[model samples]
Target: MNLMFVHDVRSETYNEETFARSYGYKIWEERYLPVFNKINVCFRNKDTNVDLNGISDKSSGPKVFFDKRIGMFKGPDVFFSRRIKNILRENIRNNDAVIVRLDSFLGLQTISECRKINKPYMIELVGCAWDSFWNHGFLGKILAPYLFLKTKIEVKRAPFVVYVTREFLQKRYPTKGISTNISNVKISKQKESDLNGRIEKISRLGNKIILGTAANVDVKYKGQKFVIEALGRLKKQGYTQFEYQILGPGDQRYLLDMARKFGVENQIKLLGSYPHEKVFEWMRNELDVYIQPSLQEGLPRAVIEAMSLGVPCIGSDVAGIPELLDKKWVFSRKKDKANEISKLLKKISKEELKVQAIRNFKTAEEYDYNFLLDKRFKILEKYKDFIRREK
Candidate 1:
């Protein structure tokens, strides 16, 4: 059976094989390929530059439908054109089952088309479009309302709904369907066991904690500024043993400028983007405290990765963050994140950190790929009849 995956995640090339080698391998291996014999991914044309340093050049992966005209905002010309809609309709008609990654402009259109044709499709609620309103630019602010409403309707109409954050997305977009909470983080049992040893090592390390987070610095909603300010507050209060290390691809000028403004420039280091293996290595060996103070989130994978490495985490009390962290480890994103975080930094002891790290390691084990793959396999078992139906 062929699976139709509708999303706007663009890759560099249009060649099916090259595209899969670069971007589609993981989804194919972990999510779609296990269930479907073949997958037909409908995605937008290449638009932005992505880091290609670590992507493997392998031949095994998914079928691609690189829609040249479909994208986030294709201007007035593409919006009124029937060709994009026709292309989506054609793609949807050829597949046995549909999986729409919601909140994308093209994906919503495909889901709407699926509804019109009465094709059974599952909705993967990964991120919320409505929560991103304040972060958008002038034109994006204008388009956000339409996208939010479109996503809301599409989710409810979907026969199956899987959310990265169970409580967060469910509350915002309620659906009466076969629903399940499935996170995308995929650690292994061996790695979890290794992390227990790492926690023991961390407990032996001295003071001068390294607080770190991984996120694109360009996005304002990530609350990078808040983390910096919290560090500044900690420094001002005579606590000078910690440093903030951020990893990810983005312009660091804003964060640098904020660090300078707060007079905590020396305490912050922007490590930039690293490969997944390197990131895990760094988290395990280098980082002492993991921080996820995002103003909003859909269950951050970075925080979970840090936890899996036996690093104690402090995250903002929003979305799925609270679900992963204990109440004491959680700080308010709006009200007193800086104060709460600074307070926690001062009060948290080494023994407490070790205990919390072990607790977190246990929590992160549930999201391991081995477990999630089985969970997903069982979930898809009920939909086998729908997935295997002929066109």
Candidate 2:
């Protein structure tokens, strides 16, 4: 069937080119691309400066333009552009199914247009957008209620909502709509030789890599500052061998200041984003532990990738993390941050670490290509019947 996959946010599609080069865009290119006969993905291309040619079966449309100087007023432009694109695409395909990954301003427009046109569309709630904005202090307190209301209205209009995290399912997913929890997709196994080479390079940089977390450092909700603080505490306890690597790009100056303020600048490595393949290779080969300290998340793709490589993860017991990981690996959501870090570190004896790694790998296998693909395809297939019944 023809499928129009709308990626309203460009950052979601090509923000990290370096990482994508090394590992390839396996999540979308491999996992979701084959399900449909044809697919069109729309995304922003300006900031990412990425060529979407090889990433998907079809090219991504132009970036949504907005007046940065005007700020809030820029919303309508995006909303209309997205709606126009969906309407045009829907007309071209006649009676194709559409899936909108609503992480952009255009999503609201697309949803509205779909309703007006009586199109069969599904919304993918990758995460709680409202919470993500509020946690980062981006969506001001004054506007939060309005944003929540807007989201609630849009979500309710969709016939099907796919949530990546259980937190989203419990807190925000509409009870009246048909909702499904489908966690992040995983990459298939790569060559062991490649994985080893990547690991060696990362290990050669330090003796004991205590913790690692990767994200656009500028996004405050990622909780990068908390990880830095935890690193400082580890150092005070004489864990000098430990090092933390912050991957991805965005506001390096701010991150540097944070590291210096924590007095752990020397222990933190700011690896500006690498190609996707190399990033995955490095994760598979070099990283000893993966930590997701995000204040909020839907289901982080990075965490799932790390687990697939047998890297034990220590993430905040928030959102969908607890659903993905075992109870033991999760740190208390309300515990003292430093104490939680200490507790996780204390559990990693060499033997226990190996066992945990294996367990993580096994858990990750459940989200592998075959498993996720089957589930997703089944959902798509069911959509055909649901649409007919709706008519």
Clashes of each: 0, 15
Candidate 2 yields a Cα-based lDDT of 0.64
- Please report the candidate that would top TM-score against the real structure: 1
Model 1: per-residue Cα lDDT over 1-391, one tens digit each = 7777776654444233334222436757667677778876776555435435354222234453444445444532334558888888887888787788766777677776877888888887877887665456676678778777877877876778888886988988888878888887757663656566766777677767888888777777788788788778888888888889988766899999999988899999998767565777888878888888886678888888888777899998878898898788988867876788888888768788888888888888777777777877776765666555623
Q: Where is the poorest 10-residue window by lDDT in model 2?
A: 62-71
**Any runs in candidate 2 off by more than 4 Å, and if so which?**
11-37, 47-95, 138-140, 166-171, 175-177, 189-207, 333-335, 385-391
lDDT of each: 0.74, 0.64
Off by over 4 Å in 1: 14-24, 45-51, 55-83, 135-146, 190-193, 387-391
Model 2, residue 263: what's the lDDT?
86
Worst-scoring 10-residue span by lDDT in model 1: 14-23
lDDT (10s digit) by residue, model 2, range 1-391: 6665554443323443322222234555554556555554444333345554443222222221121111122443665454455454554255367677754455655666677767878888776656565675644454456656776777776777777765654477574567676775556753355334434434454457657887878877788777787777777887666678888766788878878887889988888766455667667655788888887777888888887776778888767888777677788747786678766775665555666666776677667667666777777667767777766
Candidate 2 similarity to native, TM-score: 0.78
TM-score of each: 0.86, 0.78
Provide C-alpha RMSD values for all models, in order.
Answer: 3.4, 5.6
